[model samples]
Each structure stands twice: as structure tokens, then as C-alpha cells.
Target: MIYVVKNGDTLEGISRQTGIPVWKIVYDNQLSDRNVLVPGQALLLLGQGETGEVSGGRAAGGYAYPFIEPEILGQAFPPLRELLVFSYGFTFEGNLIPPPQDDLWMVETAWNNGAEPFMVLTPFSGGAFNNQLVKVLVGHEEIQENLIRQMLAAVQDRGYAGVDIDFEYVLPQDRAGYAGFVGKVRRAMNEHGYRVSVAVAPKVSDSQRGLLVEGIDYAALGENADTVFLMTYEWGYTYGPPMAVAPLDKVRQVVEYAVARIPPEKLVLGIPNYGYDWALPYERGITRARTVGNVEAVEIAAQYGAVIEYAPIAQSPWYTYRQNGMEHVVWFEDVRSIEAKWGLVKEFRLSGAWYWNLMRPFRANWLLLS
Candidate 1:
């Protein structure tokens, strides 16, 4: 589990509470020094082992491994199927590069755990859409076909059970183009008996408009994909004013509209295993936010001798502390909040929940689900 850095929390203290070694904690989290942590930053505790050993809550030889680290492998192994969705990126040459070793491990871990695994093809470059991928799909039609074929073959050959398309920030005019590309990927993968999933923006209504939400054709995506993973996080983000990651009010609106045209069983609500701590007196493009995990929040509370307080409305936890005369606010996930989200999954009869990342280890979450 992630241990957020607090004013008084020490590595030795956290290690004692978790029964993990202090050195392990330092190495697992990539700490350069023994006593330095950002209040809102998250650290992966488990080792970065092969898939099943890390994120896939898989049990091998009758032992289920603990996902103690967000990006590393903690325990030996376990036997449980974890539903995983990977966001794939392309190479500078516009070719569908294989995922890194860590990804393969994650995939293997998921499969070993009895969980179905899918990859969400996306474009990435310094946090923006990769210009190379966009050029091939938008500018080079011939290369697109080859890339699609290669992707289908690779997924099947690599033993993946499904694929999830995660194309974001597409030009509005390319809505039809995006739809057509998805159809092609689906058809190709289906012939090989692979399931197809797509990630979409959470739209409050069919008429929702904007670069972020407008291009997504929910109806078409619902029809083409076996399941649509609704991106319900980031409503409260670093760049924006503080808010709930998946606010109850906003999520209900998105879900109500989506269910109007999409089947519940084919929908999977997205839940964030992380949170953001924005600087107070937020200024436009001036105050950057820090991302954090649940366990860390507790440590932060402990560090400042700050008591953890819960928000009834958001169903989340927060803590207040002072550092160098600067007041701070921290909001993050906890077992309680995660359980609340799971309630929504059941209430909506969603196929399942998808995590934005399986990079951080949250023991509470595993315990709740397992």
C-alpha cells in the first residue's frame, strides 16, 4: 500500500506498522534518501515482478501475492483473476511497439490470477497525444491498416483475451474516422475470437459537446465494443479546482445518459485508485497539483499529528497540516471510499470496474475485493 509522506511520519515508523522492512520500503518506493517524502506523492511498495507477481492478484502454488507496491511486485503469487486494462502506446516510427517488460508481467499476472486482460491502445508523448500515432491514423491511411492487423495478431499471439481502444483528444471532425477505425479493429480481433473494449468520456447527455467529450460516439462505441470503460475520474484534478474524482452527482448524470443507449452489462465504470492535492489559493496554470494514494494519506495524517477526517458527502478522507507556515489540504482514496465506489458498480450492474492504473499497490482494495 502507498504511504503518503507526512511531517512526522518516518520510514522506520511505516515499516514497523506494515511489517515490511525499512530498506524494502525505501527501495520499493525508489527513495533516494532515508527521510524525504512529498505529502501528496505516492510510492510503489512491491517489487516490479512479472505480471502475476505484481498487479494480477494471482495465486500460484496455493499462494496469492500481495500488491503491496503500486508499481512493483510484493508477494510471491496468488490465484485470483484480476480484470486489467492496459493503455498501449506507439513508437516514433508509427509502428505498434510491444509493451515494456513490466506490462507483459502485468498481463501475465492478470491471466495467472484468472483475470481477463485487455490492452487499451492510446497515444502518448510527454503527456500529450503522440504526434506519430496521430499522423499515421489521421494522415497515413495505408499504415493504419497494417498497424491494426499487427495489433490484432500480437494480442492473440501474446495470449491476451481482449483489446480496449483508448483514443483520446481526437479532432471533432474525426469522430466518424475514429468510429470506423474502432470497427475495423473489432472485426479483425473478433475473427480471432478476442473480446473488444473501448474507453469513452463520461457524457451527461447525448448532446454533450467539447474536445474532451464531444468526439466520443457513445452509441456507436457501445454497439461495437463488448464493454465500454467509462472514464469517471479526474473531475477533481490538478489542473482544475479541487473536486471528487468520481463525484456522485456527476457520475449519476453520465451513467443515466449512457444507460439510455448502452446495456449495463457492457459498461464498466472507471475508478481512480489515486487522488490529487492542489495547492491552496489555486491560480490559473500556476499552482500544480500532486497525485497521491490512500495509504500515504494515513501516513501524512500521522506525520503532522494531523487527525484523519472523513467527508460525508464525498465519502473520502482528508487531512490538514502546516509546513513552513503554508496550510495544506489532502484528499485521497481509502478502503471506505473504494467500497463506496464498488457499491455503484453493483447498483448499476456494471460489467466490472477498471482502474486508470495498476501501478500503485493498495492492500485495502485487494482485501475488499478478494
Candidate 2:
């Protein structure tokens, strides 16, 4: 359960309202100051006959770019079982492109902090997902084998525990070929005792069609990998109109559609560790929103004297402020959003969470799972 802090809400006030002791609340969420509460901030709740740990144990994974600040990365890994190193892209000819920053330290650090590291393989080139490059690899059987071998070799050289296939923007026509490649990777990795996972675009049904959704055959991919990460966030994005990044209703629809085809336990819920701040009067194709950390978003609200409000439908927190005589809006995750999302994970009995690039300081997020 989650308790949203309100305007003028106190820990004592919350305790009285929810019938839980204030100390337990503080301990569970690791709140250093119970006297201070941000409006719309979500808090975990525990009542009689409930345990915080999910039954049958949960597997938590997260992704992080090699360039994440050392301080932030230090705080991000203790609760995670796996750390997916941001990426190793490939060219049309199947040559591997390593992460820009030296990743040896990153991989070693994750292992030291108790999370096994996995190499992330993608077809991202230049700046965005390269469909043409992905097409080249998926269309040819020889190139697929070469790419897979290079990936496995790199993972082995780095002592990585596994590899995560993260091909995106695959054309709809190449769906079967993509799935076949994933299967081949999974089998080869399994033989070496390294598990394979895949990050896929969320789909509400098999027939859902779009640049992002059309190429994803969720059921087929589910059968091809050891674990599947449903990228359930990003309904609200950088250039698009402002909205919750991961609306609960939207995530649920994706989960519902997913569990019918994929084994629930094999699915990991993909969540965001960051949020977006959009300068409004949004003009499509022109306006770009700046990504903000969840903690930073709250600080922005406070700095601007903005009062955060809860959008109950989305089960997310948002606020608006004026800057340079222009109104701005922010949609970000808070304690409530985490509880709501993890609640779904528990309800559906999914594997656990996989947070996208942990570059921000969202302390309460890790505290909840801890």
C-alpha cells in the first residue's frame, strides 16, 4: 500500500490516518526527517499480516550508462541483482561498437557492489536506433551469427554474467528473423551458463501497430529469451505533450496483454529512474523537454513554489510552474508511483523491476525494494 503526502501532511497525521506506527513508516522508507513531507510524494505502508518482501523472491535488474556519475552509481546497485551495462552497438557489417566510456571499471564496480553485469547489445548507431543497420543483420543469417559470436566473445572477455539483446526500431517485416536471432543468442548463452534477456517495446495486443510496437512480437520474443523486460514507461516523452511517463492504467493494459502470452514470472517490469520537465505551450516537432531526476523534480517544485498534485488516474505526480513568463509542467515518479508500479508487479507475480539508466538520485526508490 502507498500513502501520498498531502499539503500540510505530517508523519503523525499520516500515522493516524493509516493506522500504522510512525516509526515503522520511517524505517521502511528510510525517511531521515519525518517532519518534512513533500505533497504528492508517495510513502510505503504496512498493515497487520503483511510482509514487504514478495513471495518466492523477486529478481531486480537495472540498466546504467557507463558514464553515470560514480556517486550516483554507488547508491544504485545494492538492491539490484543484475546491472545491464548501457550498450554495445553494431554496424551493418556486424562489427561491434563498444560503449563510449571504458566499461571495465563499471562492470567491476557492479560486481563489487553485488550485482552481476550483463553486456547490452543493440543496433543503435549515430544517435538513434538504426533500422537500416538492424535490417542488415537480421536479414542475413551469416551476419547474425557473426554478431552473436562477437557479442558472446566480448561478454566473456569482460567476464560479464550475460548479454541483453536490445535491438529496437526493427521493421515489422523482420519480426521473425529478430526472434530467431534472439533464440540463437539465448541457446548459445545458456550453453555457456550465461542468461539472456531482451528489452522490448510494450504492446497491448499482437495487432498493435506502430513504429515502436509493430516490430515487437511479445509472445514470440518471450519464447526466445530467458527473461523479457516490458518497457512499460515512456507514454509521456521528451518531445511529446506532457503526461505521466508510466501511467498505471497504461502499464496495466500492457501487462494484461503480456501475461496472456508470456509466462508472468519470466517478465520483468521496466520502469523509469528519471522524469521529464516540459516547457509548455508545447509545440510539437520543436519543443524538447529536459529530463530531470525524481529528486531533482521535487526540488524544482519547491524552488518555484509549485505545489505538486496527484493525477489519480495515472497514479503519478505532476506540477506546473512559470519560467520566463512561460508555463512549464513536470511529470515524475515518487514514492506513490513506485508503490503503484511494484503493486502491479506483485499482483501479477512478475519477475521484478528493471529501471532504465540509473543516473539520478532517487533514494526512496531503492529504499522501497530494500
Candidate 3:
């Protein structure tokens, strides 16, 4: 069972509530400061030895840029079966534009760490993802075939186990066109003994709308590809209001809706490995939140003497502190919060979970999933 830290809650208080001892709570979460219990921390009522032995294997993957920090990359590779190298873009003329950063090192690193590296194919032109570029490629039969031909060849040359098609920001009119493109890619790749996966924006229903989400037809994509990765995080975003990155209530709604349309086994729930810090008073058009790793968030709480607080409804940890004559609010994930996510995987009997990108160092998450 998971226990949420309430106001005025102590280790002994939690012990009495759950009938577990104070030492057990301390050991499970690896609490460095036992005396300082903050509101909203989720406590897993199990010991270190007990967790891994029982919860060892669950299918998991993570996205990573070609240039990952050496220290952060070392701890992440062991936990993923597939590390999606982000990404390989395509041109309007049907030529593959590979990642700017060399990915040979990442491919080799995945192999050394017992993971099967996969290539991420995206629709990009010049620099960023272009909906017009996607519409042009998918609209023409010859261009689609040409792109797939090059993609398969690249996969063969790189020794990638498969590909994850992550075409983003597609227009609403291009929904069926994009779905057809995915189906063609899957058929061609499957013939070469390569699997294809697709990432879809999270939605609670077919009627849900926002931020280029209309282009996603969840049911169609689920049938087209080998698996579907639900982009479940980022309800709180860079330009959005302060909130949980992946609020539990919101994530559950997406998963519930997805399973009704797609097979539960084919869904990989996406979790955020990092969080954002927003300077208060937030401005609608101008405010931008700087990204921070989960471990770093806690350290900042300690450094500034800010008490970390949790939102029960969101199942997320956050805190407020003043620095340089400015107030800031941070919402981030911890062991308790992630364990709640893990429970959803079991509750739904879904395939597994994956992180957005493994750039940050979150040792507790590494320990939990490892």
C-alpha cells in the first residue's frame, strides 16, 4: 500500500497509521533525513530487499538524445530493453536526414548494456517538425516508398532491432493520411524482421482536443504499429500553468481511454524523468520554466530551506522557495509518485512504462525500475 505524507505527519505518525515501523519507512525510500517529513511524500511500505526481488521484470524503454551525459547514461541503459535514439528526420523530397549528433556511440552503448537500440523516425524539414512536410510525404506513394526504402536500409546498416515512428504536430486533415503511412511502414518493416512502434499524444477520448492532438487516431495507430507509446506526461509544460508533469488523475484517464480502443499490452505509458521550475507571477505568453532533474529538486529544497509539499490529487511533489528576490514553484516526481504510476501498469496489466528522455540523473527512479 502507498501512504501519502500529510501535514504534521512524522515517521512515527506514519508508522501508527500504516502499522509499519519508523525504520521500515526510512529504509524503503532511502531517506537521508529521517526527522524532516514533508507533506505529500508518498511512502511505499516495503523494504529495499523486498522491492526488487518481487518487482524485478517489467517491460520498459526510454528515449535519449545522441549526446547524453556520461554519468547519467551509465545508470539508465541497464533498465531499458529499447533505447530510442532521438531522432532521424525526413525531407519533403523523401530523403532521410539523420540526427545532427553521431549516434554510433549510443548504439554501441546499448549493445554493451544488454539493450536493443531502435531508430526514431520523425517528419522534419530544415530544423523542426513540419506538418506540411508530413502531409507531402504521406500524400505521395512514391515518396512514402522511397522514405521507407531508405529507413529499412539504415536500420539494417545500424543493426537496430526496430524503429519507432514519432511524427508529431500533424494537422487534423492529415489524420487518415498519416495513419496510412504508418500502416505501410509497418508492413514493409515487418517483412524485413524489424518491428515498428508509434508514439501518440495523450487524450481522454476521441472528442478531446488541444495542441495538435486532433491528428492522432489512437485506434488506427494501435492497429498499424507493433506497439503504441502514450505520451502521458507534460500536462504541465514550459509555457503552461504550474502543475504536475504527470498528474495521477490525468494519466489514469488517458490509460483508461486508450485500453478501450487499443490492446492494453501494446500500450507503453510514458513518464517524465525531469520537472520544471516556474518563477512566480506567471505570465501567459512570456513565462518559461527551466527544467530540473528530480534529484536536484530535493537538493534545492534543502539548500533554500523550503519544505517540500505534495498534492494528493496529483500525487506529485512540489515546493516553493524565494531566491534573488523572486519566488519559484517546482513540481517533480519522487519514489512514492512513480510507484503510484507503476501500480497503474499492474492495475491495467499494460505492457510497461518509459521515460521521456534519460538526460537527467534520477538515482531513485533508476533504483526503482532497475
Candidate 4:
């Protein structure tokens, strides 16, 4: 669970309210001064739970919707054992809708293929960070109750075996609220015989505070949600400096901290089937958010006549090409990088690994995991 410090809220008050040990919070963030917490800071609240080995071997999974266009769904279903539906959420104005038509086909195809369909829910589209939405969906009592009811109804009507809530950019203050939301959702889904899961940021400790890390209360999620999916990708991304998609050390830091709070069996590591190419001489104010999947990125490199180079630290492939005399760096995942990440999943004994939006056709990724 996360505790965002308000202007007047104190660590003592938060600790008292949540029943979390104060030392753990301080130690998790590695703070030199315990008394200093910004207004939007996030703190993780660890709870007692099962800890140890996950004996299961690596398993394959995919994210999709059942209602994709006939051609798309037909092309997508033959790949794997698990199909994760995109979402079911109220719009910004607050009206509940079913998954998109394209997604409906994807979900149906997974079922027909004898694959389990997992439904993922989010408050925002395109993975933007939204704190106010998190507060309303999780902090506000009325909204939380309504969301839980709607979630249960959707799972039953759609015949989903499991539900994955992927709420991102939550405010620091809504830490407990998010935890409460997970608890309520879990209760509603479990009573109805539905599996409940949550998507969390990759963090090693509970006290970590950053816009991305603050929103996810890893410990609370570990205790409340049936499965905690750690997004272990994007170490190298479009908006940030050029780097590998999922570096080995960064992933390990997240897993090491996560296991201390969550059971290894419930952890689902995220694998990136994608990569980013950043234009050099980067401008601060300008936006550079073009991210490409592995297949597309590889083709882009070939098109530019860019020779691919490998980074041992990142364990991913990259190449620098000049376009109209401007320097650009492209970072992408390949067989070697995917294998390194998969090795981490095996070492951690995680429940499984999930890909982010299987919109791209990366044949090699499936082959490597299979």
C-alpha cells in the first residue's frame, strides 16, 4: 500500500492508520532522512504473506481482445495459451462500455483456442499517467463501490477466468485508496469465482518515490491481488535517453525488492517485444514518443542500411544511423535480450511473464519462449 504525504499528514499518522512498520517504509526507499516526505511522495506498506520458491517452469502468454477484425484475430490466436483482453472501464465522463469490437474477437479466439482469457482494466487509454483518476476510482468511496460492482458484472457476463487492473500514474496520497480498491475488487471477484490480478511498476522497495513508482503500492498489491504483474520492460524508451528495452540489472533490482514483499508465485514479469529509436541532439521541450516493436524496428534498421550493434550491459541490439545528417540511435530487443529476461523469470520462480499489447507480430519472441 502507498501513503502519499499531504501538507499536514505525518509519517506517524500514516503508520498508525495503515498498521505498517515505520522502519520498513524508511528502509524501503533508502532515505537518509526519515522526516522528509514531499506532498506527493509514495510509500509502500508491506504485509505478512507467503514467501519462497515458485516451482513452475516458464509458461507462454499473450494479450489480446476477442473482437478484433476477423483477419487480425484469425492471425493472432494460434500463438499461445493465455489471451488477455484489453479492458472494460468507464470513460473520463464516467460511462461503462464493453471491450472494443476488435478486442471482443481476440478474447473469443483465445477461448476457442483453448486458451484462458484474462481481462485487463485501466482508467486511462494509451498508458498515460493519471493521478486524479486513480483517486476517484480508488479513493472515492462511491466510485470504488460502483467500479467493483461493474467489474464483477463484466467478468460474469463475459465469462473471463481472471481480471487484471492496470491503473497507472496514481497519486501518492491515494496509496491506501488504491489498496482498498484492490481489496474490494478482489473480494468481489473472488466471491464470484473470478481470479483478480494487478499490474505494478518494477520497484525493489516500498518507499521508492517517482511519478511512475509512486503510483504503485507494490506491497499492498502483493498482499491483496491474486497476481502482481511487474512491468519489467522499457528501461530504454522513446521519451527517455536511448538504452535497451529491458536491462538485466534494472529488472533484477525490481524483482529483488518485489520478492521481499510479494510471493514469487504471484509475480508476472513483463517482457518487451518492442524497442525505441531516439534522435540525437535531443530537444528538451519537443516530444519524441515514437516506439516500435521488435519486428518493425528491425525492418526500420534494414531500410536505413543501419548495421545493428549489440550492448552487453543491456543485452539488446541497437544501431546508430544518420538521416539527413541528423544522428539517431535505435534500441531494440532481439533473441539474446529476450533469453536474458526469460532467464530472470526462471531464476525468480515467477508465476509467468506477460507481453505488453501483442499488436506486433514478433515470431522470434514466441519461438524463443516456446
Q: TM-scores for all candidates? A: 0.76, 0.89, 0.88, 0.78
What's the TM for model 1? 0.76
Best by TM-score: 2
The C-alpha stretches of model 2 lying farther than 4 A from their native spots are: 1-37, 43-56
lDDT (Cα atoms) of all candidates against the true structure: 0.64, 0.85, 0.84, 0.69
lDDT of 4 by residue, 1-370 (tens): 4344566666677778877667765543334456655443334454443111121345557565544445534443344666778766665444465665645455566788867787788776554545677776664677777767776776776777878888877788887788878888888888878888898877776677787778677888888999888888877766777777788888989988888888998998888867787888767656484788676675665466666666777767788878889888888776557667777888988877887757665544553343
TM-score of 2: 0.89
Better of 2 and 3 by lDDT: 2
Cα lDDT tens digits, model 3, 235-280, are 9999999999999999999999999999998999998988999999
lDDT of 3: 0.84
Model 1 weakest 10-residue run by lDDT: 56-65
Alpha carbon lDDT at 101, candidate 3: 91
Candidate 2 RMSD to the correct structure: 3.5
Q: Which stretches of candidate 1 lie over 4 Å from their true place?
A: 1-85, 91-94, 100-102, 130-141
| Model 2 lDDT per residue over 1-370, tens place | 6676778888898889889899887766556566667676677787655544532357777898888888877776567788899889987778888999999998899889888999998888777888888778888988888888988899889989999999888899989888988999999899999999999998897888788878888889999999999999999998899999999999999999999989998999998988899997899999999999887787777677788898889989999999889899999998778778888998999989889868887766765676
Give me the candidate number with maximum lDDT: 2
- Which residue segments of model 3 deviate by more than 4 Å? 1-56
Name the lDDT value of residue 84 in candidate 3.
88
lDDT of candidate 1 over 274-315, digit per residue (tens): 777766767778877788865565566557756666677777
lDDT of 1 at 231: 86
Ranking by lDDT: 2, 3, 4, 1
